[model samples]
Target: MTHIRKAVFPVAGLGTRFLPATKSVPKELLPLVDRPLIQYAVDEARAAGIEEFIFVSAPGKTALEDYFCAHAALERQLADKGKTDLIERLAPTRMPEAALTIIRQDMPRGLGHAVSLARRLVGDEPFAVLLPDDVIRAPKAALAQMVQAHARTGGHMVATMQVPRAQVSAYGILDCDEDAARGRLLRARGLVEKPRPECAPSTQAVIGRYILMPDIFDRLERQGPGAGGEIQLTDAINADVETVGVTGYAFDGERFDCGSIQGFVEATLAFALDRPELAAGLRARIDRLAGNDRFAA
Candidate 1:
């Protein structure tokens, strides 16, 4: 089995949803509690054993690149203050310094186009693609689980979760049969890009994590615009499954769709309430909301 060594992160999109907040700052840099969104994605990739990081960024993302850069001054200042623990916590976020490579996506072509920009950097090897906007928090990171599934099955692996029948229209739905061995696992026969609720093949929707084979580059290269005039990753993945087999791993994780306003708020509350340090405060706040007398009927 080919071990996936590289991962592509598409950070080129203009975060229009977040508006003024994301105007000066990239959406990937949005803070989730204490850590930046991109940090969570990078940490997840590292846990999945990815050695090389290829980020597809745009003009205003120098700050994003700088965030991962070594902070010699900060380290020295921490050392002077005897803040050894703080320095240690940040040290892992710095990858050998050279492991990270950035590519500029000249335009907001699409997710597939952003990934295609990393082909030269990825160099014909299997690579993982993670959408930082969809942060999944669990005991075992979602990407790590996908990699393990990739090792088991030589083909591509897509992380999936159960979506309500009415909500299937919002995601890239999958067509599959129940795995004989694993109840959650599915043998993905095909993928449909945001099918209508009535037209969706199955309720199993593909999430943001994917372990793709190099053949996807070719598909993306020739793939036409679907939802918009931009090349979609769903088209490429679906193309591969049409010719070859693809597998879906029911990820054992809780996903926070930070792409939208409601989802981001929910993610914030979930993450904050789960922390032992802040659970009490969060509970108190929730209790106040529940018992507020202002809205009583």
Candidate 2:
């Protein structure tokens, strides 16, 4: 099996849900805690041995590109102040020269179109696709787990989670059978894009992480508008089921859907509570707020 080297990040969405805040700022640049949402995804891809990073972005999202570049003035200021620790913390944000590539999507077609834009950069090798909106908290990065599984299975793989049955329509549902030999690995028969609750094949919902073969680009190139009148990535993957075979790896992690306001706040509080410096004060504040009569149920 060929080792995965490149990863594509589709960051072209308008982020309408965020309204005023996303008006000028790309959603991926929004801070999850101390770091931006895209930072976590980049760190996760690096951990999984990805060497080349491709960002499929739209117009007005140049901030995403700037975020990964070194700020020389700021660095010099920090060095002048002898803040070595601060400099070390900033090192991870800079992408190595030529390792990062930005491609313009030019339109808001859909996930399939965005990923297809990276075909030339990805070439014929199997590559990973990571959606920054899904911030997964895990002992092992989610993409790394999928990479390990991909090494053994050597086909298309996707990170999956069992969402509530009622919520199946919000995600691409998988028709799969649990692999008896390997726990948590599901052998996919097909995929349904946001099927109604009663029509869903299973509760196994496809998440944002994927390790897919390059042949998928061909499918996406020919695919028509699906579901919400856009070129759905699920449709292209579904087209490969009979020929390529797809596997679902239920990753061991707590995924925070940062695409929504509620999930963003939940992730912020959760990450803040994890930091020793902020936890105590945050906990006290939470206690006070909960006890206040103004917040009474």
Candidate 3:
């Protein structure tokens, strides 16, 4: 069993969608509720037993790097004030001093390019790739589930979700043999990046989570700029389809596309409702807002 001790987080993209707000702050640091978007991804990866966290970052993403580092002053302040609960909550954000590696992606090439940046750090092992933009809520972390699937199947594993056919073009669509067991795992035949609806292989879309073998670096190295004239990760994965075998695990979860405005709002509300302390209050406020005549338009 190849132990997946490392996980790569590609956070190099300039978030044009969030615009003005993302202008100064790294979009990964943007809060879904109280926690930053990247924190959720990190938590999921941590739960999956990942030991070393590798962040592929861009020039302007200093805050994203700082997020995982300890804030000594703040920790001291909380400790001195007897805020044990607050300090305990901060434990997840702190990594063992040597466990984090931040690599720079100098250009905005694409997701594949960003992932390739981590090749040296992840050499010769199966590792996971998590896109912080997609925040998933589930009983078990989605990547944790995918890791277990990879342990059993010994191949490339990607987290998948069934999106509506109309929305197929927005994601990397998987071409796969349907599982007779009707379980989460699907044997992938191929993958396409943002294909038109009529040309789509299936309505099953690949989400942000992926557990890949090290040889994927070889495919990504030879890959050319695709789709939007940027190297597409889907293309690289497809390149290895025949040789390594790719599997899509339909992860049990609800994914929130925090990279988009609507999805960010949805994730915020969904997480808020899950908190028992805030559920009733948030529900009352939501009901009041819905009943407001001003919002009816």
What TM-score would every model get versus the actual structure? 0.94, 0.97, 0.96
Off by over 4 Å in 3: 179-182
Residue-level lDDT of model 2, residues 1-297, one tens digit each, is 329899999999988999899999999989988899999999999999999999999988999999999999999999999998999999989999999999998988889989999998999999999999999999998999899889988778989999999999999888986544268789899988888999888899999999999999999988999877889898999899989889889999999999999999999999999999999999999999999999968
Clashing pairs in 2: none
Task: Report the poorest 10 consecutive residues by lDDT, candidate 2.
Answer: 176-185
Mind giving the per-residue lDDT tens digits that candidate 1 earns over 212-249?
88888888888888778988988888878856568888
Give Cα distance to truth, residue 101, candidate 1, Å: 0.4
Model 3 weakest 10-residue run by lDDT: 176-185
Candidate 3 residues 104-148, lDDT tens each?
989888888999989999989999999999999999988888888
State each candidate's clash count.
0, 0, 0
**TM-score of candidate 3 versus the correct structure, residues matched by position:** 0.96
Off by over 4 Å in 1: 179-181, 295-297
Q: Order of all candidates by lDDT, from best down to worst?
A: 2, 3, 1
Where does model 2 exceed 4 Å of error? 179-181
- Spell out the clash pairs found in candidate 3: none
